[model samples]
Target: MGISVEDEHGDEVDRIVAAWHLERPDLDTAPMSVLSRVTRLARRLDLERRAAFADQHLEPWQFDVLSSLRRAGEPYALTPGALMNELMVSSGTTTNRIDRLEREGLVVRSPSPEDRRTVLVTLTAAGRTRVDTALIALLECETRLLSPLTPEESHRLAGLLRALLLPFERPRTAGPPRG
Candidate 1:
């Protein structure tokens, strides 16, 4: 873990691949050279995210939901169904989260003016402050995580990752709000 990935002598991934090569000489472990580092980096990023949220007393899902609402701007509101879709969670989970957030005074649930049958979940001032603080912290941590890479390297990495992941993802959609 202490080894730098850029070291010409090699890093932790090299050590792991060498061990696999020793034990299973016939199999090609070429993919591990790239993917193993990505896996380790993801674990580290998860830790960073948790640490960022810790000071704000936020769970990851809380940050996700609050951030989603914050991004909507203005009234900072969205329907429970919109939230469920955005968060990729079940209807029940969305309701439970909104209920807890309402109880905490971080958000409010009210009947939508646009539709009587639907409920709107709006972020309270407290929620905005909390989510904004958490966002700044998370970005700071993430910046440090990528400190080893130059901006050009980061951009290239992001593009490569997008290409790698696109096939496994749902088809790209225009991300505007829809009625």
Candidate 2:
């Protein structure tokens, strides 16, 4: 079950209530029933995901790097710059993560033949096996978590989420807002 903003002493909820009171006293913040629970549940989910990864002797970031390559198919490689963008991390941070994965023999750095200055990171055979195993386990864990919901319900929920997300995915325009 998800936690609530009114959990325990309700400190977080109280702050949220106070903020609404000060900013928009006419509006009720009861919508937090869903939003607050989502926030709390997301944090818990992160911990759960990390634990799952750890069980396979992988860190969450390691899984991310390896899985990204695994998903690329074929050559199973991507540049550090591309990875930094996809992973939403700074160049230096992506480099550090890649360095750690390389040290663990999960990935290797190769010079890009097309661009001598650029490098590509590729998952090793061992990395491929480990990532595949971890992915299967992760999917199983996710499936068990969603067991309460039917497959149709899961699809509907995904559609609903994408509907809510699509507006934000579009590029923002500076012109006057359209009705």
The number of the candidate with the highest lDDT is 1
TM-score against truth, every candidate: 0.84, 0.78
- How far off is residue 103 in model 1, in Å? 1.7
Q: Write the per-residue lDDT of candidate 1 for residues 107-165, one digit (tens) a residue.
A: 99889898878888999999999999999999999899889999999999999999877
Q: Report the lDDT tens digits of candidate 2 across residue range 1-179.
A: 13343456555655675566567868767676456766876787778778778777998888998899999887899999889977878999999999999998989999988997989999999899999988888888788777889999999977987876677556557544344
**RMSD versus native structure for model 2:** 5.0
Q: Which runs in model 2 stand beyond 4 Å of their true positions?
A: 1-26, 171-179
Backbone clashes under 3 angstroms, per model: 0, 0
Q: Give the Cα lDDT of each candidate.
A: 0.89, 0.81
Poorest lDDT segment (10 consecutive residues) of candidate 2: 1-10
